[model samples]
Target: MNTRTVDARGLEPPEPFERAMEAIADLAPGGEFILLLDRMPQPLLRMLDRDGYRHDARFREDGAVEIRIGRP
Candidate 1:
């Protein structure tokens, strides 16, 4: 599947979330929005869950959090 990535490691508050949300909004059908972060994003995960969006977040071998989001 095609993917759009937002590398948010070391970014300040809101910037990473902003970039991820933007990328998610612009994703093509059947594409994925991948967010790379230093830690898991609880707020984003909650929002996705509350909104019934399909999302998966896992820790990479390097200890980074990788979140994949698909359209609801």
Candidate 2:
């Protein structure tokens, strides 16, 4: 499966969320969207959970968080 990545590290509130949402919306079945952020995106995680998507978060050595979201 191919993965699309969105870099949201320096972005302010709502922009990262919006971009992630847009990416999620455009994802095909079995596709994955990876979000690179400065910190954990709790609100977005909740939204993904509510929408029944599967997700995982990993912390990078560079102090950024990588959130991978995929269809259930």
Per-model C-alpha RMSD: 1.4, 1.0
| Model 1 CA deviation exceeding 4 Å by range | none
Model 2 earns a TM-score of: 0.92
State in Å the error of residue 63, model 2.
0.4
Query: lDDT per prediction?
Result: 0.85, 0.89
Candidate 2 local lDDT, residue 19: 89
Tens digits of per-residue lDDT for model 1, 1-72: 457788999999989889888987787666777889998899999988986678999999999999989885
lDDT of 2 by residue, 1-72 (tens): 557889999999889888898999898877888889999988888988898899999999999999989986
Which pairs of residues clash in candidate 1, taking residues 3 or more apart in a chain or in different chains? none
TM-score of each: 0.86, 0.92
